[model samples]
Target: MIFTLRPYQQEAVDATLSHFRRHRTPAVIVLPTGAGKSLVIAELARVARGRVLVLAHVKELVAQNHAKYCALGLEADIFAAGLKRKESQGKVVFGSVQSVARNLDAFQEEFSLLIVDECHRIGDDEDSQYQQILTHLSKVNPHLRLLGLTATPFRLGKGWIYQFHYHGMVRGNDNALFRDCIYELPLRYMIKHGYLTPPERLDMPVVQYDFSRLQAQSNGLFSEADLNRELKKQQRITPHIISQIMEFAQTRKGVMIFAATVEHAKEIVGLLPADDAALITGDTPGPERDALIDNFKAQRFRYLVNVSVLTTGFDAPHVDLIAILRPTESVSLYQQIVGRGLRLAPGKTDC
Candidate 1:
């Protein structure tokens, strides 16, 4: 690719490739959101001449990885279910684990190297489609060079980078799960870098986040046993929270709101200044989504309310404000939402 690689990014990619060549074993890359992990993968594919198979967890990610590889000059093909193939006749194929799992017997296994994006999602044992992919790959090619990439290496409920030394899938020095961290590159840093609109820091205000009704619907009590149930009916961002977000947005031009559900997102749109708000959800038709994106780029939408989407791939440089309305125990998810504001905009003024 013609793009320049940051020092840290190059080092991360170098470390991963070194591991792959060293032990002939799988290696993982831990990069925060907005750190251009996709670019790192592209760089790897550029140098490695073998037929590369990239396995992504979701449809959106599959599309993103495919486009990124193509941009990096890798001939790419996608075998994801229900998705049409583009013109990128790929030496590298990006496939959904589910799609390949369903059509395993009919597919070819000539790929010499395999890359797993978000490898932490590879479920336990050989039961899940992910684990099944690993098994199938081993059966098809014994000398496969495997590489995994994700922000968080430790699987949920698994111990930190320390306890996962022998966690079956994690590669590299178990202690080096983290590189020099890049957390300082959040919204505050972006504002300082002039990448976003100057933060119009007005007098601080008090805004309450009311979770009463949601708590009431979710058995009126918090419990690990009720998490999934609570997530289903609970409001991702409450009206009080929305008011605070609006206040914050008033200080910035473009704002990004992360909500829990479609219904919650609709409520957020209603609360934002009408005629200047856009909402994107999984059900948003493709054409409509493209239009919304265009309008957003045109700055017609001051606030973008989103539900469970836009955590990755979707990029808006004007996103000066980010509302983490969704409660998540995942550090990776939190970092992803926050990194939406990390792009360094030069010559920006601090408000």
Candidate 2:
């Protein structure tokens, strides 16, 4: 089975290959959320020389990327504990950082290229799991090349993920993980090219929650404790917000609601129709979470309320309405949350 890459995807692959030819420093590729990054990863792996290892922070991403690579009639092994597999001898291997970091000794083979899916998650902390894995891999192959792919290159409190962007879109930090951004695909370009759904923001709601009074932590994000206390005081307003969401969702096919916390998610779910809604949090059992997500994607329910779990790896293309009930200072997080609805699905003209 052969798959053809889109023009922009091929361009991304070309840019990455071109970057590696000129420099040995690590670089990143920035593509919008809805873009087919998995395909690009697969293409790069196909053309890459020597053994390749693709790393993702979550098991879902490892599985998804591996599946895409395999769909091209390629053989690749998955090294994620969540998937109950840990084969590392294949020329191309997809792995979750946690699993790979824990069992670094299991991998006897040396890899030439290391690709990180959500590279922005890599911080300057040398003790972090990603850093630990990279350090080990670098020891195995000192000349190893690193490539990162992500939609949002900026971290929450930190600035850019790369020290220098291709066009200097923004200032980069000296402590950034990746050294440069070799290629970037803009969200506007994707929308203009019909590759993604155009997002439409509704007018200000009649009832709104004011997060201005909440204090910010040193990380430039609101503390969950402060948010919870403030939410408790404004508990009366949650119903009004849900009411507006419900009214808006009546015309939408699929709706995803992002809540501040688990308790808030449960409260919102309780207010919604039980049969038509479901709640998912980090604590939800793995099998149960998978089932809930499967059902939601199958349109078993119209509303899915979650807290921090569905921001990155989860995918539901039919989602036409995104109700962000939480507040965040991170531009990356905000874009990720809203990206859930930006996928171009049949009958979904806009989000």
Candidate 3:
């Protein structure tokens, strides 16, 4: 299949090429979720002569990226754990930082380009697989170009978008390593673009938020160093809370409930409107996990309750109700989940 890039996406590709011509160094492109960032990167991989290293963080995301680029006529290989590289000398390689961060000696400097997905995590500090990647690249492929892509470009601690300017990550920065690829498509923009449907949402209406008990548990009323023991006890009472959500979302189509733990996910599944709910996590085996996502996308399931596993790099266009039972401090994650619901439906925006 031939790939036709979007206007902003094409602009990003052109800007990346221009940057490459000038710096011959890796660069970052910040684009919103569902903006077809993968498609752009995939096109780059298709045209790349030498190896192209595409590094994603999660296994699911790694798999998603591998599939996308492979579809672009780029012979892509996966180096994730439990997955082996193909015999095809494929020009594109999708590696998970979790899978290969500690083993850079093997892939170091081998590829001419390094693509970091969800790159707001790269930040100014040195840590995580990102820091490890920079360390390896600086030593091995000092001239190796970096192409970072993310929806939100700021970290949790960075208060303002202006900090991105100072960090030299924003296009506004004079010493910017990579110019802004495109920040035009926020979730709202995606909705206007007909890529996502606006979601229906309500603040979960429970008489109580389990506040006092949570405070007590935190202040040491529990025997465990963890909060699970208390959270589970509290969730047993959540069935009553589910009734409220059911009533509020009764007319809504699909819902995703994000939780803190597997047990929490399980309880959410149980409390869901029944017969149409499922759970997904890192623990779910391959076929089953894939099925859940497929079914969710196919509208076979109306609800999917999961942990942090599904937050990033996951998209179900028909999902029109975002039920956030999960707590988050990161803007990147918050925007990511919200972006999932912003794709415009058929009558509205771009395909």
Candidate 4:
């Protein structure tokens, strides 16, 4: 099947090509959460002269991107061990960073273009898996070009990916991963164009903990373990919050509740309507998680509680109500959480 891009998406592709021609360096494309990034990636692979490697942080994204390529009549191979796939010399390869990080040497083929999905995750740390893989690949393919795609381009403390510079050490004042942002589709533009649902922040307070006392981690965010412990103390108060959420989202069709930890998620599920609510976390088995997500998407459940699972690649347009039970300082995390409900639905005027 032939695929077509929206006007802005095509423009983004054109801008990326022009930047590469002029500067010959890595570039990033900042598109909204619901924007068709995979389409731009597909078009890139279609026009590429050599092999293309699409790197995603999660298996879900790797599969999602590969599926889009396949629908567009592109032959793609998966490099994720979790999916039981091996590296191949396919023209297009969808790779999970976690799976391929350890086996970079296994992929002997030198790719001409490296498209990083959710590329904002490439941190400043030189020893990070992303940097490690790139460092190794640079020697093999000196002329390899990078194309980063992300909704949020800035890190917690690293400023923007384009201006990321690490000082003090062996690699002081190092070059950033991307030369510049070639294209940016702002959230306001997407909302104004009716491509995404306009979010309405509910004033209901979900947690009642002394967040000020929580110590921050290196990323300038509260430690997950500490936050979870604090959240656990509020388990007894979840039923009240659930009741308030139910009242606030009375007319909404689907509700997604984000929690700090698996135990907190379980507590939320216990408080919610047992027959209409489900919980999923990183620990949940793959089959069970998929089933829960499928059920939630099918509208079998009015509420779905999750912990660090349903943030990015998961799409549920009917989720008009988002109860952010988990508080996060990371702009990317906040965007992803709110973005779960940003896809435009038939009657979804407010998110």
Which one wins on lDDT? 2
- lDDT at position 57, candidate 4: 89
Q: Model 3 misses residue 327 by how many Å?
A: 2.5
Q: Which ten residues in a row have the lowest lDDT in candidate 3?
A: 216-225
User: What's the distance in Å from true for residue 281, model 4?
Assistant: 1.0
Per residue, candidate 3 scores C-alpha lDDT tens digits across 18-95 of 767776644556677778888887877776666788888777678878788777665667878745552223567788
Collision pairs in model 2: none
lDDT by residue (228-340, candidate 2, tens digit) is 88899999999999998989988898999999988889899999998999999999999999999999999999999999889988889999999998888778889999999
Ranking by lDDT: 2, 4, 3, 1
Residues 57-87, candidate 1: write the lDDT tens digits: 7776788777887886556788887476532
What alpha-carbon RMSD in Å does predicted model 4 have with respect to the real structure?
3.8
lDDT per residue (tens digit) for residues 34-109 in model 4: 9989889988888888888899987788888999989987688899987789775798889988877889877777
Compared with the true structure, model 1 gives a TM-score of 0.75
Best by TM-score: 2
Q: Report the lDDT of model 4 for residue 91.
A: 87
Off by over 4 Å in 1: 86-90, 160-204, 210-240, 346-351
lDDT of each: 0.64, 0.90, 0.67, 0.82
How does each model score on TM-score? 0.75, 0.97, 0.79, 0.92
- Residue pair clashes in candidate 1: 75-90, 75-91, 76-90, 194-345, 195-345
